[model samples]
Target: MPQKRRYKSRRTNYRRKSNKNNRTTIILIAIVAVFVVSFFGYRRYVQYQSESKVEMVQQDHSQFIKKVSPYAVELGRQYGVLPSITIAQAILESDWGTSSLASQYNNYFGIKGEDPSNTKVLQTKEYTNGQWITINGRFRVYSDFRESMKDHTKLLVDGTTWNSQQYRQVIQSKNYIDAAVALQTDGYATDPGYTNKIIRVIQKYNLKKYDEGIK
Candidate 1:
């Protein structure tokens, strides 16, 4: 009877140890799960912050476009051209008013003239002999930025001999893309991708709505 009681006590002790081990395993699993969830949550938060910053930068660019739109619209009203087209051209040609020529000479439209008496000579890059070569070229210089804008409008309205009529008709359509393409087809820019870039800038900032005040 003494031996049997001892054996029964030992069995109870083994069962208790097994239950304690199982509880410890469960606790470890719960801790690991919590740590994994926290890591993923932190990663998601970082991603959200990065995306928000990008969106804020884009908003700033849009605001800058808005600030410049009114002047472009007024210029168009005075010159009988499309406001968005004028703005896009200036932005493209002047590098958003950061170019040296734009700052110093107000020559945003890159107008060129052959008359040595009136033309200003500047060193610029030109494509020649299968490579880019720097050469002195004569470009039209304006006394004011407004004068450059005026000359750009005049070039579109009267100087273009091929598609002047088509551009004039499309400029009244209130569609920026149409007017941009008209300029491209009429050789307003030397770049083949000029029209697409203008369209992208206009659409990205929703610039066409400003034209409502022009009429």
Candidate 2:
């Protein structure tokens, strides 16, 4: 009877040990599953953020087009400047009116002015001596978007210098392509690819349609 009792006690201890081992194995598997799920969850979160940013970029583009297209058409009809080039330049220069200069002062054309009352002092990158240099430039400030557009058209039409004929080619050009090329040819912009950039913006936004159906 003592031997039987001893054997029963050993059996009970072995069962307890087996139960502990099984519990440990289950806990390890649970931890691994949690880790795998967390890793995939993080990846999905990152992908969602990237896609959201892309969507926001597209939204920004459409919003810009909606805001500026009508004004561009009106300005072109009044000032004889190519509407496509005008809108494209506004996009390129002001980054769809998102730049600090445009935001603070409504200065879309980068027009310089000495008026102390309506101006924004901005750090500009100028190409000088075959290199780019940062300089503080005073940009003209306007009361509204229409004023800004008016000022830009005035500059291209009347020109900045006393000689109001600095960019005559642009004013005389019949199409957006000619005006874009003329802007570069007449040293309106320092960048070598300025014309291409303007043309690219016009094409990307389908701004030529604004020029259409206008007398």
Candidate 3:
């Protein structure tokens, strides 16, 4: 009878150990599964945030283009300037109408002026001596973006005070490419890559289509 009782106790002890091991295995598997799920969830969240940012940026750019295209097309047709060139210049110089000059004073073309009452002194970067330098510049202020666009078109048509025929090539160009190169040759901007930058903006946004209403 004593031997039987001892055998029974040993079997019970073995079963308890087996059950403890199984419980431990289940706990470890559950932990691993939780970790994998959390990692993938976090990855998906990050991806969603990145896509949202891209979509917002694209929407902002589209809005800017829509707001400016009508004025550009109208002014281009009246003044014989390519709307693509005008719109591209506005986008590049004003950073999609977000720059201080564009947002506050409505100066989209960065036109400098000397009038004390009609000009705002602002810091501007110039590509000079093969390097970019920040300098104080007096820029003309306008009542609205439409006025700014009108002034810019007039500048191209009437030219600067020193030379009345400075931007003649820009108005006479047959296509966006020629107009972009003419702007550089006509000294509209000092940056060495100004022509290429203008061309890239026009191409990226398909700004040439705005010129369809004109000749």
- Listed per candidate, the RMSD to the true structure in angstroms reads 6.8, 2.7, 2.4
Name the lDDT of candidate 1: 0.75
Which candidate has the top score in TM-score? 3
- How much lDDT does candidate 2 score? 0.86
User: Which pairs of residues collide in model 2?
Assistant: none
Candidate 1 per-residue C-alpha lDDT over 133-193 given as tens digits, one digit per residue, 9 for 90 to 100: 7778788777877778777778776665454564564455557777888777766655667
Ranking by lDDT: 3, 2, 1
Give one digit per residue, the lDDT tens place, for model 2 in 34-109: 9999999999999999999999998988887788778888888888887888889888889888998887778777
Clashes of each: 0, 0, 0
Residue runs of model 3 more than 4 Å from their true location after superposition: 1-24
The TM-scores of all predictions, comma-separated, are 0.60, 0.84, 0.88
What does the lDDT read for residue 144 in candidate 2?
A: 81
Off by over 4 Å in 1: 1-68, 115-118, 125-135, 160-173, 213-215
Candidates 1 and 3 compared by TM-score, better number: 3
Error of 2 at 44 (Å): 2.1
